[model samples]
Target chain A: MGHVIRTRTRASTVAAIVGAIVVLGLALLPLVAGRGLIQDMFFILTMLVLAQFWNLLAGYGGLVSIGQQAFVGLGAYAMFAGVILAGIDPVWAIPLGGLAAVIVAVPTAFFAFRLAGAYFAIATWVIAEVVRLSVAQWKTLGGGTGTSLPRTATRDIAGTGWIEAALDVRGAAARDILAYWLALGLALLAIGAIYGLLRSRRGLALASIRDNEEAARSVGVDAARLKWSVFLAAAFGTGIAGGLIFMQIARISPDAAFSVTEWTAFVIFIVVIGGIGTIEGPILGVLVFFALQKLLADFGAWYLIALGVIGIAVMLFAPRGLWGLISHRTGLELFPIRRRLITTKGNDHG
Target chain B: MSILSLAGVSKSYGSLKVTDDVTFDLPEGQALGIIGPNGAGKSTLFNLITGNVLPDAGRIAFDGRDVTRTPPMRRCLAGIGRSFQIPQPFDRLTVFENLLVAATHGRGQGEAAVVRDCADILERCELSARANDPAGGLSLLGRKRLELARAMATRPRLLLLDEIAGGLTEGECTALIRTIRDVHAQGVTIIWIEHVLHALNSVVERLLVLDFGRVIGIGEPGEIMASQEVREIYLGIEI
Candidate 1:
């Protein structure tokens, strides 16, 4: 037992160090890369965030919600409203978007909680469509045509006017670099937060509830409360990712803000390929997903088909997923939540 | 004091009655054994006691508090810990993780304490050697041990065992009986439903028999076994 604890502690320490190094590398990437690459990296970082949140929800919480796009669209609109109408800064808009997503999640959870199993999944998808339609119909925000943020030359060019007027051209690059760092920082925090949560008591309850709801309830776990909490957290995380996405693109429209196909597909692919239920799976899956996307960009529609096929194949052949399969074979866990007694002390302890 | 009492507890699904006007008192620290033939609604009685299914017409009192409409989790928190007839462990989690979840959530214990309690339960259940194995991969005996470990992790004053020794070998059943005796000595109340008459005979002093959702016999295990009603309904047939 003592040895198992020591091994787990060592593994966690190694994971922490690796995580710090990855964060540092991401923080420094914008400095080394050109503006285009930095922009692409920002997009990928947002996708990583989305994937991690979805992975936590469906993979660990067993929610399997298809309507997460409701929060995604809500986040985009919240950012747009915060920046354009409320006169909030772009950075502050990200959290405001998350808050708005939470607000929407409250009602969504109420209706969605009434369902179970496959019905719940389908209900969430319907809710997302309802939100999308409602948002598209709101004339004040652009309705069907969709709205655009004020992109004055001052805002359009990265760090152009005010910073340039204050110092030299280097100042503008510095500001853009700061924005990239901000996105990277948020992504890392999301991963770290999820990792910590999965190691906490609440995470264990969620896992128990996921694996066997009947048994969990029999043991005094409030399944509804845990499911709702995870649902809300997932919405909040996806909302933040949405805001980052719009920030990277510097625009928001109904169709673009509510693009479930892209966000859901990418996140589902990442979790399915990397491994569901492990904190490290989303990170690894995101990296592999982006690598494939970069390599197959020229394939256009085929690229998406390839992603779908891969996801289906992985689900069929490797239900444990890549990380799950590896962990099964090697018994090496980076995030060790349980202590296994390696050697029995025999009748003494008994 | 009676920790739990059921008064005229009746439950039905559509036209079929599963638990018919069943009444019993579980005094604090008492170990009660329930025996019945297949389809005697023994499992349904366990479910009703644990609040998995609401009693259609009855009153359930736990620790002198009414809990007829209470949810399953609430009943669990109020000191009811039950295992399924077939072992149901969290398939994706390791044995230790499964118990850790039960310890933390069932008793609402903090992380460190829950961990300690989970380790202790694993050791007591003789599952320490396979603690790291995924629950889905466990053998029948291992799975049964995990089911018991999970229930024990709840730190319940009342533990309900639903046919836990059903599929085990005679030797395994003896081992499990010994474990239950140890737990009983520690002052935990137990309600065991088992087809293995000898297993219950070894552990429990009192026995109750059910048939067609109604109590047919209740007395000391030896006397209940000798009763003509019980023998004809359950024990007369070959083992």
Candidate 2:
């Protein structure tokens, strides 16, 4: 029998069918749901996008960077600079944020790749702080105290008027729905792109490097190049998510843009709680994270303590994350990366 | 002409030199067995040749091209493959996937070529039954086989085997000897550092002895075994 490498399972096929339908259902939520619900989804979807990019960087790329907020804050700042200073439309400026992040990633990779382990993690945090401090000095975008987009710019964002008419909602509610949809699209794209990359040949090389870096070099895998590329890609995607997120909120500040606790720490928690390596893990992780934020966000300092407690519990018990626990019990993988050998009927003829 | 040549290669950590001015020649398709007492720098010699460790004073030429300064990956891509003294397979990957990485990256084989070559390798290494299992789950013999299989996947012109038969039982050692013999028959040059004398003798015609990071004897396997100085240094015989 001839071998055919297969990663897709019957369960995965079924999961994809159900998952597609579910995403479609989510897309139509703004039609029937209240503005508050739409706004909540915007938060959840953007966090999912941010979390997925972080997972791809740390989980698959073997680069555990704590400075992801550097990109988020930079992207948001770029979006603001594009709209307020350059007179570009806000919708058009969104992609400019992603581009700005990618441009910054080149220099960041050179410095970051020089250090490893805890030193590398700390180096990233330091760099992020530097970025925050630097951005705070930009007087054009409102210095240390921070600034918001112009009233006209926020009010005249592309598609808001069209969304208001189509959804039969007021202008404000329409903006919320439109931003919610953008978050949903970004979330799907992030997951799909990561899944695709992890299944490719480069993904195989990346896995080997993560498994054993020295051994990977012995087998001719260029560890440095692969790590650099994954880092830049994660930065690019994170920047876009950051831009989209801030655009929805219509405000920006150096501290708010580069908040490590809000962006990086929470993302790490989601991936760890849900399962860092698997794509399905982040979905499960983000859902759990969003639920906790909504339900207990106002319990004062106790809420932070509760989040810490739950994060530790999942990490200690599950280790692989919530999706890991689910996969272990049910043997189901919605986004499988392992290849299986199957025998084909035409093997003998060949 | 030698397929691999090492001249005056030396390395030291502080004052303790692991390899001191070591020099050797390996002709095409020749199988040379290296036997040394513990801490004799036999494995260090292998690392130097494979470019995992650079020599302080030496020239290494593979296929008549100098590769002393090349990095490990470039040396690997240039057709030098070696197994670790301890197996270092990617723990989370399946056995087939480990080989797939080597075949693609080390040998630069395309997708279809890698698949076909990997199947043949798995069968040759007697790992087809466990190809789908994680490398970490393999038995001792299985892990050793994987180490060899991955190195072989690179399609090396010069293969270095480090203590491959060290911990195997007699029966397993015999199987490994046969595998090594088959590999030699395929015209790939081999330099094996082994503690298992019987296993080394069966596959290699030439034997080189080392002591205190210096070569003590180099000749036919029987001649090296009969040398008086080799007996004193390696076997600790008074004669």
Candidate 3:
């Protein structure tokens, strides 16, 4: 039989074309956008990166980790240690931060694996707190008091001089632009990687496991192996995002780096509101989150309360999130991970 | 040649014995029917064979290889596929995708084989029209067919069907029986656990009956059904 497996629909085919153009447009946006806008984009892109990783873990892998902030903090602190103690350039230190998170994640994954569901979420949060406490004792990176990147390191960061000359801007503007480009690039890589995994057999396996673990196992799915791989991969991506986040600010401390509200809560909110499993959801989720923040930031306490109210409303009215609702109405999947069966019955299975 | 043998297989939940030294042999490519009242442990036997539950004692050999310690998936990969009493389709996945998982992971087939196998199995089960529908949205009959279709996609040598006829309309049951007969005709072994006597009677030549986890009778279906002991214990016929 001549049969084909497909994920793309007619809408997704068109979306792919438009999406590529949008990416190209986004790349060129830095050329014309002002400094503040680039900075804002940096925040949104990094949050999207973190949200996508979370989506992969909880949305597809069936892992609901509440302590992803642990990786974020670990990554940020690692960047500080690399720059301050190891005398590494701030730019190169970003990858070091991610490496640090991976090192910590290996041991944490084993511990977290023991618990499941709600317990797993709690265990991750507790471990994150422990990580933050452990890092707090290290005086070399300013200990409990926290510290900033040295002036010399910040003044001559990797790609800073080149970006300044190329973009024809001030030193501060060059720094922002450099961070902006890096954020854009990493966000694209994150989305691409998630899409790639979801398209492969691995994605099918994860989907199987998430639907029903026992049923998945009965069908020869190595549920444990698939889950562990997803957990670790998400941790690595989150670590990279975390490092980038703090590197943009050029400051780090256990409390600031590991703040649950800043790193984990906001990321969870984005994924939850956007649509947990699909690649398009987080993009929409982040924009909505930013829009809400901008409108409500002046309200302070009202802003936080309003977020809670809206989150509840969404959960009740549309449990699948905004993207899920949109997909149901429009049937447009930008990153199609679902397989379609194309059958040529004339060629029978002999 | 015997394709499977369960010798002195036993299992218990606390003090309740679900399977007490249950033993049987199934010949290659022969369709066998198992009948029992509620709680007679027909499902437990299926679990033992499929590796969903480990037998407390004795050996389970498949094609002359001891597989007592093999995990459930390995048992499936080793050519033992089964359907749940209640259909367990991967609900979020499309019916086609559900079959694709079996053809790929369970059968270890490549892309071309998977695509062909899934399509063939879907058509065989009369699910070609509903292939694009999400499994969760399928009607009961469709879900049941999807279950059988998914099991067949694994290309199993021995298929264990647990109550495949339960909750089906007479027409649906007849359709399923026809499909099961066709599967049997292809020389694939079948071990069906069902309460629906007529459905079982249509497909299997050999019938095995259980009561309280012990074999009550085993023979040709007509011989066993007409026996005095079966009439007294199972049929409870006064005439």
Candidate 4:
């Protein structure tokens, strides 16, 4: 029994060390990369956030909602409203967008939770469309033509003497590098939060519901409540990603803000490529996906088609996903939510 | 005093009556066996008790409190734990994680205690070896063990086992029966729905034979098995 405890302690210590190293490495990347690379990194980080959100919803909660773009658009628009209308700082707008998404998610979850399986998926899609159409008809937020953050405001912020003063020693590349670091920090925080949530009790309930709704209910899991919590969380996460995407591009349009095809498709691909239901899978999947995108940038539309093909292939061959297959072989999980017993010679009481 | 009482419980789908005026009382810590052939509403009865299905017409009381309309989770929190006929472990979760969920959320246990109880339950179910393995990869016997482990994790005063021994081999069934006996010995009231007569006979003292949603016989297991009406409806040819 002592030997077993010792072994488990040693294993957990090693896992903790590895996790810390990985996080620290990610945290420091912005200090090393160039301006263009930093911007690209920011985009990747945003993608990672979306992937994690989708994974939590479909992968863990068994809520395969295609309408997550509703919140994505809502978040972008929230940023627009915050900065341009409400006069809130653009950076602070991200969390506001997340909060707005949560507010919307409650009613959406109420309506969507009534349906199950395919019907639930469809209801979410319909909800997204309703939001999209409503926003599209609103003449004030650049209904169809799209909206752009005022260039004057961008120039005013960029011209801040403090940024220039700081970059004087490191050159213009330093400012862009700082932005990259900010994006990377956000991504890491999002991933870490998800990791923590998944290791909590609520995560277990979500997993049970995902596996078998009826059985989960029989065991006293309130499937509706759990689903609602996950829905709001997912919406909050996706909305933050949208806010970050807009910050990187310095613009937001109704079509672009709500573009399900771009953000949702990319997120779905990342989570699918990585193992769904595992915290680290989406991060690894995002890294691989970004690598492929960079390598095949010249392929244009073919790049998207290739991505689709790769997603299909991954699903067919490794339904558990690439990270899932690797984890199966290595038996290494950075976020170890489950326990295992190691029996010793004298531990035969069980 | 009875911990649970169901009176005039009836459930129907369109024209078919799944539970027909089924009534029973479960005194605290009493083991009740529900035996019936296929489609005899044995599992449905358990569901009604746990509030999985609201009766079309009936009243249910738990600890003398009217809970006829209480949700499943509330019932579970009130100390009712049930296993599915087909063992449905959270496929993406490890065996230990699966039980930990029931312990924490279903029973509202603290995290450390939940972990301790989960480990103990896993050990008792002989699943300690495969505790870290994903639930989907388990064998039929392993799944059955997990099903029971999860239910026990809830720390229920009343447990409903729905054909947990159905798909297990004879050896596996015996092992399961022993584990269940140990649990029952701990004073956890059990209502088991089993087609496996031997397994039921070994564990339960009283048997309620159900057919077409009504109790055909209610007595000691051997006496109920030997009843003429129960033989005609459930036993049919032999045993």
Tell me the DockQ of each model, to 2 decimals: 0.60, 0.65, 0.63, 0.55
Q: lDDT tens string, model 1, A1-350?
A: 32222226666678778878977787767546776677677767788889889988898788888888888888888887788777776667778889989999999889988887799989988988898888888786788787666654215343445544643436436446556776788777887788778777787787887788899898888888888888899999888878767765666677878777877867888988999888768877888898899999999999999989989999999886888788778766777765454443443232
Candidate order by decreasing TM-score: 2, 3, 1, 4
lDDT of 1 at B75: 87
Off by over 4 Å in 2: A348-350, B236-239
Interface RMSD of 2: 1.4
Q: Report, for every candidate in turn, its global Cα lDDT versus the true structure.
A: 0.81, 0.88, 0.88, 0.80
Error of 3 at B182 (Å): 1.0
Off by over 4 Å in 4: A1-32, A158-161, A169-178, A342-350
* Model 1 misplaced stretches (Cα beyond 4 Å): A1-11, A153-178, A340-350, B114-116
Query: Considering summed lDDT, which 10 consecutive residues are worst modelled in model 4 chain A?
Result: A1-10
lDDT of 2 by residue, A117-204 (tens): 8888998999999999999999999989899989888886899999888879987798888899999999999988988888888888
Candidate 2 local lDDT, residue B73: 91
The 10-residue segment with the lowest total lDDT in model 2 chain A: A341-350
Tell me how far the alpha carbon of residue B123 in candidate 4 is from the true structure, in angstroms, after superposition. 3.5
Ranking by lDDT: 2, 3, 1, 4
Better candidate number, 1 or 2, judged by lDDT: 2
lDDT of 1 by residue, B1-239 (tens): 99989999998888888889998888899889998888889999988888888888999998899999999999888888988988999998788888877888888887555655677778888987887777999989888888888998889989999999998998888888888899899999999998887788888878988888998888788888878787778646753
Q: Pick the candidate with the highest lDDT.
A: 2
